[model samples]
Target chain A: MQMEATIAQSVSEKVKTSGAEAVIRSLLAEKVDLLFGYPGGAIMPVYDALFHYQQALKHVLTRHEQGAIHAAQGYARATGKVGVVMATSGPGATNLITGIADAMIDSTPLVCITGQVGSHLLGTDAFQETDIISISMPCTKWNFQVTKAEEIPAALAKAFYIAQSGRPGPVLIDITKDAQFGEVEFEYSPCQNVRSYKPEPPINPEAIEQAAELINSAKRPFVLFGQGVILGQAEEEFKSFIEKTGIPAASTLLGLSALPTDHPLNVGMLGMHGNYGPNKLTNECDVLIAIGMRFDDRVTGDLSRYAVQAKVIHLDIDPSEINKNVKVQVPVLGNCKETLKHLTQAVKRKSHQAWLEQFRAYDQIEHEQVIEPELKPLGPELTMGEVIRQVNELARGEAILVTDVGQHQMVACRYTHFKQTKSNITSGGLGTMGFCLPAALGAKLGTPDREVVAVIGDGGFQMTLQELGTIFQTKAAVKIIILNNSFLGMVRQWQQLFFDKRYSSTEMVNPDFVKIAEGYGIKGRSIKQRSQLKEAVAEMLDHKESYLLEVHVGKEDNVFPMVPTGASVSDVRLS
Target chain B: MCKDFTITVFTEDHIGLLNRITSVFTRRHLNIESLNTSESQIPGIHRFTIVLNTTEEIVQKIVLQLEKQVEVIKAVYHLDEETVFQEITLFKVSVEQAAQHNLVERLIRDKNARILSVEQDFMIIEKTGHKAENDDLLEFLRPFGLIDYVKSGRVSLIKPDEELKNLHELVNEAKQANNNQSFN
Candidate 1:
């Protein structure tokens, strides 16, 4: 448990500081303004140190550790900075697992610090002594444990560097109790490189030329992108690339906000429940240029039939992602901003008017069969789409929308409009429920000037409803909209469509959400009639503070344009 | 095809390094048949040898994944024919029976094993070979009042040298950097 004294030896004057103080000082040096965490016995020293540095940092005490991490994720997603989360050992550390996994799959940068028992008591089944490092190893970009005081600054620096660099993900550092209490001479330095680790791999120029040649020569070129654009902050570059080429582009679920929803070349989302044109035309496209997206199973249904006719050009930052799922004719590896800038310089301006019209034709058909009826509901019951449609109009498609996972998540992603980059945050790869409530808190905290809206379903909202206390304390000014369908609507849709109408346990008997919002001292309202929908949404947006609006929607409504399980992306259902 | 393969990983020695390495296997649900670890020829680095029965496709993916770990320097897998591998086994037999029979001496000589020590209660026999050969010796020594047995995980060496002169250079440069006051 001895720490290396080599790094701090050169300092002319070294202040003796405890491990806890070193951690605080390191965070300050990293310019971490806000941290979200919960306190416990093992982590008390750090919290005690946090008390001394209250003026320099802002710490949000979430109701649960999961809330803390998801809030951090929201903050990270909204802003490009790495988010920080802290918790104690055992249950406190374990509670952050879901959010950690969510951040890992979605490539959000987060640094999680968990307390451990004394160094000597790590493996003796001591109270609150769980092996957080081992538990988080698979999900983290890198993880380490510090049992000695002198190692605290070095490990924190490494953790921050690893978490924020390249294809960012979560990194955890578990510090034992002795390290927090022990004092050592401290000198802080940021880690710029690790011998075996290279954050950004070098891009191949020849492959970029190959990709540019493919884009220029093809008549029916299509672009599919994901969060890598936002992660790289290359939204402008992506927009210019597609606009200059005059090619049709579609986004994965997490890539929604990277391009303006109303952009002429930006054709909607690309997934199972995505827009009609994107899903149906994936196999028909000639040259498929995938940027920053891994072609996840949800986006590429029945991989054997997905984009088989197309010559694939894949651009990504991670090397392992390059032929991991779909084979690529040309692979360009590096940060998307740098590579896209290079590709843009090489690509010539061209238009595929005929190919673009085909997408419009498909969109027209989908509009006639699906979007029209949902937006203008003739039935007595309210629908989820109408709620999204109203919200879309009132917000002018500019509000940052944080969505929980389920049928409602699909509905929001489908109908919501984005006018700016980094405006959409949700659990895309992990499909984690209860993500929006706390994430919306983080998002609003990160971008206080921007309006933040959290769209949740009754089933998903109930999972993390305890975060209402956080909202009440922080007054994050997030607009919470709930689409209340009395069932776990997505699973129920599957049961109805595929399982012969056997509902099973998908149905949920719930309490009044508006009443619950009132208990948290937040403004609230619920609408069951169509006449109240527009005004209620407008009022929710007009309110200066946080507000919750619940709308009762059709119980049996299902998300359409779905490529059935094990089916090709082209075989989308309209009902 | 699904068969035995040994994956070797080189990494910097650090606390929880073993747990980090094993967690990769645990995540993929790949069962480790045998594993061995020790310091390599290079200073400040450690080597781990892990044996798993999986398909060639899976093993390739696993190596790419293991290389992604921050501390891991390199990860490569080799088939049985590609490398020379061995596992050591020890057998302890009753001392009284050992004195009465010539079969024990004959079996030990045939297997190329040798007696480590002879004590009052039991005698110990040691053998080093592949798993199959070691198992054969254990079976041969079982009938003569076998007291206890233990076997170590496999150790392996490929045919060609795994020389990375640059890696040694980096180590030396790190030492040089430590002595001076240069920061990047």
Candidate 2:
């Protein structure tokens, strides 16, 4: 340790470094390998410094700033590390707003660095200058601006710490141009503690005891978890706790892959368009143990009627989230791993076979009414579920599945199977349409050994279709599957069901996605008929390089088992 | 349900924290009527007083959201009757009006305002009072040649019994926490 310290000191003294160089050194100190960014005038100095550190780090030049940030989110989601994104001020910074907001609501950890105009020109409305810190304030977990060269390392350390710590979310650091170019006596020390911030608040022993006692005494217990399980990297802990108690577990869309989809205890997804059983049984469960899931409005439709019969025990790391929505009878404020461990130790070993069987009965009903028909449709028009079904079989439920937001995202989340943890990534809260392509690129890069597949809708695919250039440059082996229905299917479905079929602007006339893939120097296949689905998907998956498979799905198909707008979760439709 | 609500927040002086704090109002679609920020008596601590027109429910939610901010020490909302507050208004008027008529002097006497400066082009007058009193003085001075006018947001102090002890305790705890940390 002394020798390493001496070496670090000598290295710092050898280089009379600018703040840009300090930024690179700090990132290296933090051991960040991959960076997604775009270059502009304000951030050019950092890019210049980045050129020197190219040997040690990998910088992915995405087509747009949004792509860069989303890709960083993908990297973070895949690696459970802080994703790093760099962009210039104004337009470059503003372009990251959607991604930042997406990462914020979805709890993706990202460290975004934006370059600002000189500090002296901040308020004068200098060229290409925008109040990025102010603009990103609501969306970021923590954000700071550094004008002095000496503050660069500390700001960056804090940014990374805040981004990755406690219910992880995006954090932004705005660096002034003068600071980037100004020289400083560089010394990098990682941020350990923030006086005003407490990432992990102390856990309440009484809450855990009450939770355990409730779980033990319950005649019918249920477990509903979400991305918090994945965020805490507590899949093993959660599995142990659930298996010990024999509680039926339902996952939020973001929590899909935290446990094996095929696991007997893993009930199904819980929300609109979710499995029939979880939504129906939510009202009947006696003791609902919600772990690491914020009861989003989508999950708790008609909040007054949601889980009203049950006594809820919610274990989460964020204290503010405890009673923000659904009331919790026992609020265990801690990370899922710690809270579950404590609860598991005290909980009585019991099985609720009767309660578990009720979920299976619901699953049977959904399978016959919705799942079977969607996965094996009789109509001439192919379905998104069939395509996902084929991908599920070919990928053997092991591939990392990334989906853009829309009908396809829901379809993928509903149908795709994952045998391992961290295999599912999507924009759940923000519902950003163009998240898949760039995110897939980052996912493939982050987990290069694993099979990476991106499921997107034609509408969403076109939103960030420009990232094909990124794929062409990086040669990422991400299998792109576009469920092309030639319309905004989700919106079209809502119109069909709720808006008196006012189609209006929901229709779309798209180009040949195959031709577009060909133009980007990627192999492509198109399947228009149901008969051609298996062969085309097989061919796309078998191809050596990156491949795009466009499956023409039914245009007017509506996602079923949906709780109608402002309706109770128990009122899910099977149509 | 829509009535004026004042929210006071104690926090550390972190750059862009004001933006982060204000963004909560923006996200909830609540309009900020007035905002004032200044250093607190406790060293290294800052306080922000934000006024908005919102329902009791929305104000409660806003305070909760504000307290969730990493830099924010504490946040609470107050009704009109709960706090003793004042806004300082500076009225700049044409010098000719002050010289010609005793109207300016008489108004100043009646309003309990003091002349800040007498310039060649304009004379500056300062008034400290509740928002209504300041507005009333402005209305009376409207007949006079007014050059410019500015009013600060409500600088509020909570009633002794209503003042939060938790905030002061939290600030002290934060200081103690920082002192124990050896990272610096």
Candidate 3:
């Protein structure tokens, strides 16, 4: 009886299937439950296959191809799993370029499948044909073009593996239409090895010891971490490492929510609009340990004058990032989860009371100069910071805060509180506008239990507002707060600070955003008065469905603690 | 601070890898002086030899970026003084012009060039040397009505190491261990 069953299973597994069906089966094998995409001519066969598999694979039809990709990014960031995106050739594939680049720089894992023209017509300028594999080469971690149906199963298996392994980034697999329609014997085995790709470097005990010794003997050691901790799922390990040493830590923009916002040693955000304490004290620390974060120019400010007084220790999964930016004294290369555990075991428990107090002193100065006025402004006009403060009060650090670019993004990053890892999703690397609306919808889908709030500026809100249809269709229950300044706020701030305040095409004659949301059948409110702020935010949050709240904020309000271009972090402004 | 450097990359043989590798240079606005690719000593693996003139800092960054490519196993850059390198150039000259200039024959023989073919209309001579030597021969042949000339990119071997072999052995051992663990 057992032999008969085994033979039957083998026979069933060897059944012939179309390449499009194989692609669906491969996704099933990878345990992909949700997909974000748009349907078009080149991808019609795959969409046809998808119809029969709707019960198993849920597909969200985003309004635009760019919206689909960004939504996939949000899903990946929220769930810590590989996000999947599908789009047709040409413009459909090109629309994914921004989000692909964003995923690459931020290390979000995504597997993007783009349909191409028929194999015979690939280079012949067939309708909807574009060389996406070549176009995405610079951005994707790896990419392949599949011209034969027989290659579908293996190509998709490899795509999932490459996209999710070792310093994860987006991977593109372009399939010709003929290949999708052709028949093949479907078989799949998850790729275990690629021969050429080594995802994780072996941890060196000696390097761990060297880093520990440096940390132990240092007068003041500071930790600057990025999304690596969360990407590696090493948040607990990171917390233990910092808590044992009692060293105050700051985070790069994407690194927020990896460590609890209210943790004793959690200092603040780091970058151009970062807190005054971390920026000012960067030069004062004797030892700087950077984990899972590259020293971006925004974070480091002037490299020549940044952390020159410190002996740096960098722990990262990517070896190329070790000396690519600021030079490090000890380089620990491996998954930070394992590396942090090993380092935590090696380092001694100690406290830097005086060093921590120095941060508090600067924090006090910053609160007086920057934070207090913005969050609790005496001015009649609403401030972006106050809207964030209200949302933080209502959500209580539980909501997933997804933000778009510009002043609202900085303000939300500055004021939003997060208690759990992966709770803060934003366009960190690309600074992409119009990212919040669709990304919030995707985040809500990925983590259905969490409240996903999107804080967007007036200018950015208009970019992807078409996604209100997506919200209405899916009923994603995303809470969107638009800080309406009626200007391209960040550029205006820059012009005010450096460009002599000549707002060149920065002002906007806006539309009725609430009416637009209502047109899409989503509930919304437009508020300008401070008295209505609390109830308006509460109403948006309390609504059973997705809601939009547009608050009129100060038009010329600028984000402070700014590190002027080419200036040192110590010279961060507080106006 | 700009100086000539040779970068050798060991990678898995895969389609589109060359594009992936070159785009790193293209993105940085760095121009390649020459580039060559072929199978390496190890079975199934490919090697890339690229020559460029850039600041050491920029070259180091470029090599690091190249190593970041998925198919690329390893990438290392070497200063000109650290490696022995040469390029193979083929010159096709008009037979009539070559016979008119007796000095061309002497120059070819003096430079250790070999006559590969002699057709009625053209003669083909091959020379293997560094860029300077190849350029000198080209200038000499230009007066002899050089019909066509083509030179391959620099092919180099590091002076004091067989690092590629060592890396291959290490990779093999790692693969073996992974297989054993999976079986268990």
Candidate 4:
């Protein structure tokens, strides 16, 4: 019995494993439960290894490489975990470029693994070879190419650490096929530190004190927050800071849902199609405190005229974002969760009742001129705003709303109500057109208990309609609403106003979307009349499985509260 | 507003870091006039010297973006007045022409250039100076049948005390802290 035990122990200690198996083992060690990927020639070995480990790690086969990466992004945004994706070399890796760029600009955390050609075949233009390392360098926070099996574990660990750390972004690791086939003694150790990469900068107490003094003395202090709050898991800290200061808060498009929609201090969204109060009051505020949000061009219409009167206090984890667009009086550099706590303790509480009333007055004007007419239109033609209103009423501010880019996306961001953080997901920075369908599928998988709804446009829905097959196969209960306008609505709106009503290539004759859904073995409904809207959305929400609901709305409807291309934010029009 | 600026980056030696550093400039459509890379006094650390002509505002932004790279320890930019820098240029001339003209030898002596090599067919001259000085020497040598001309990128040192030594100590401390935490 002793000799038998000795033999078994020695055998277990020196067992050899392939790099493909090592990749799976490393993922399991990282506690990665799900992956979005598609099988291909170069990546076949990893897929083969994945088959035996199916019970521990679940793989969702997406229809395309772009779909896989977007789905991974959705998963990351929904769960605040690093999303994982895999694809083959050459065309497969090239297809993921758009999503990588989208993730980079939006600060989504993802680790994408691509299979490369054999090390010997590199630079020889072998069948499926491409230099993905160079192609992905600008977009990725960091990336590495592994030509040996021994390098797999360390590369993956670093990829995950870099991807999900401070100011999170996407990272890529390209593993050669020969490495996947080679053998090694597989052991896993998670990366805890990279000497040159400091994920979090040291908090400066003096900067926080300066910011608080500005907040305490201001007559009208306005707070602008973004996805950084959600990404940092600092929603509670942000709420405490705003509540303590009694400051009015506005959200950028990506920052929506970081603060509850119905919070008393919450004003509305800010951008080209943002609310009347936030855009106009931006110029009126005496002190502007921007937290965990970069000043994107869409939010600041013309940098020269944006908030020139205000003393800006910017809080961000990234130092580069401080003076990139607008100069700030006090720069607080650290995680918002930590910096907000310090600021909350340092500030003095005082209500700006008169300043608050200014925003309320602007809100009243916007409501009468824009909101009331769009949500409860007197005309026979239905508007995109009303569809979102009905969905909001049914979902009760609890569902996860994923939107594609277009007029419908703007309408959804403007109208959707959220009671929770991380509940509103969209392609904010990159404004990717086909992001909604696959992203919703990944979000649903990430949080299976939540009601997931994908709000898409007629134009954007056709961009990745094949994802319906993924929903059909997985039986994920995602509610899809297509506000079909039979035109590329946002562009058509711009063409109408800016291009002398020349429709150009904006008009689209779409396919039978509901029929396509049915062909995928999922139930769906189509509606054109205003009367059927409420009941149809309710049915979609109550369905036990995946359902598609297409609502045909006004073809030339424009997203309003306009800040035309070069106009100042204060000059936003409500017509 | 556009003037010469020198950017120095200290980083760990890692594969593909150079590409990551250069792409930051390419993304902004900024032209890099010269670039030099070498090992620093500190072991295992590398230094990159890049010279560009841009506004102070844009150069500051580029420096911040460079430090954002994972392997980069620190990135700092200095105006020409704040730094002492030089470029080395090598000129190859036909030996026949050099011996035929006393002006070539007189010009080399006047310009503080030294003869690096004297072969039967070709003569090589080396000069270390600023860009304008090198250009002047090239102009003087062109009439003497200059066969080939090559100039190295600008290599620079900040006029102030060495800040990187202090930064290197801090980096080591942080790495030590990381190691201690991992043990727990």
Itemize residue pairs with steric clashes in candidate 1: none
Ranking by lDDT: 4, 3, 2, 1
lDDT of 1 by residue, A420-501 (tens): 9998999999999999999999999999999899999999999999999999999889999999999999999999999999
- As a whole number from 0 to 100, the lDDT of residue A428 in candidate 1 is 94
Q: TM-score-based ranking, best first?
A: 4, 3, 1, 2
Clashes of each: 0, 0, 0, 0
Q: Which residue segments of model 4 deviate by more than 4 Å?
A: A1-15, B162-164, B170-184
Model 4 Cα lDDT, one tens digit per residue, A9-98? 323343467999878877877888899988888888899988977877899999999999999999999999999999999989999999
| Model 4 lDDT at residue A543 | 95
lDDT of each: 0.88, 0.89, 0.90, 0.90
Report fnat for all candidates as fractions from 0 to 1: 0.33, 0.46, 0.44, 0.53
Tell me the TM-score of model 4. Answer: 0.97
| Model 4's DockQ score | 0.49
TM-score of chain B of 1: 0.87
Question: Measured against the native two-chain assembly using Cα atoms, what DockQ does each of the candidate structures obtain, in the order listed?
Answer: 0.31, 0.35, 0.43, 0.49
Task: Give the 10-residue window scoring lowest on summed lDDT in candidate 2 chain A.
Answer: A2-11
